[model samples]
Target: MDLLGNGPHVRQARRDAYREEDSLRTRRDRFKGFTNITTGSKGEGLTCCFKSDSDVMRVIDNVMCVEDGVNCNNISREITFMILNFRYYYHGHCKLRLGRRDQFIHPFVRRALWNDEYLSKE
Candidate 1:
């Protein structure tokens, strides 16, 4: 009883589907709290941006890569992880309200989030 039937194209498509599913899962797990993701040009190359939603006590680790987008460099490496300490200065503490999921983050807002000192404490 071949539930998936039998065809070269069918098998290839199924494999591709599985691969895509796995890739999406990897991104989701790697960037659990991230939301309102979008892609656009940054300087000269394309970039992906999203707001994380982890609580003040959560630890930030791991570099995240998104589908059809560039790798996140600023938050990709090791840092002291001071989001909790500076949570009060930001609006939602940990829950970044990024508006529509399709809308790219504003340049000013992105710059604010990507602030060097803030991103890499200690």
Candidate 2:
């Protein structure tokens, strides 16, 4: 099975593997950059009114930046989960859960991160 260099399929497979690896590497780098900015190590100028490393700050930005036709309310659920995960990691429990989806998402987002419930079972 000297397929490594002997067949077009093998060559295509190798190309596909290389492309996948490259894509993953690019995504990893992009995430690393985001992590740096969100943690306040970079892009500090992008945010105001909240601590740079606050996950709530990132969630607010992301909610505000969504494209038209995409419902920010719907996406807020996911963002709530992200914030909750961050809280659970840094602290021991999530003390926040988002309000009713029918209400605008930004108000809840604007509330202090530590003082709200964005992912409560209710």
Candidate 3:
């Protein structure tokens, strides 16, 4: 008999519990105008064994990232655009700079700007 209860059924039960918890957390974040994207071991439903830390990425809904050469003439005025500058970094990583001078700057991003330039992934 399995005294420790470390069988396949037990493992699957743990994963299902963790997944339900994550779904609730994600729903809460959505109400706050942010999307929670889970990653790492805990996100993959591997919480049956060793302890794992939760890694979540909260993406803001009002902020938008666009390419350096993309035309923003048709974009909504309420959305804040962060122009991606690829010249300073390699692929898959880039620095987020402010868009056109006429563009409206969100208060949150405006407070973090350094000389009208946003933060980078350096």
Best by TM-score: 3
What tens-digit string does per-residue lDDT give for candidate 1 at 27-110? Answer: 676646323221222211122122232121222233122322233345423321122222445664443332223334444444
Q: What's the lDDT for residue 66 in model 2?
A: 29
Clashing residue pairs in candidate 3 (N, C-alpha, C atoms within 3 angstroms): none
* Residue pairs with clashing backbones, model 1: none
Model 2 agreement with the true structure over 1-122: per-residue lDDT tens digits:
34434355554564454445545654666644321122231222233324255321222233333222334445554343222223334555443333334434444455544344542422
Report, for every candidate in turn, its global Cα lDDT versus the true structure.
Answer: 0.36, 0.39, 0.70
- Model 1 per-residue lDDT at 1: 16
Better of 1 and 2 by TM-score: 1
The regions of model 2 sitting more than 4 angstroms off are: 1-5, 31-122
Candidate with better TM-score, 2 vs 3: 3
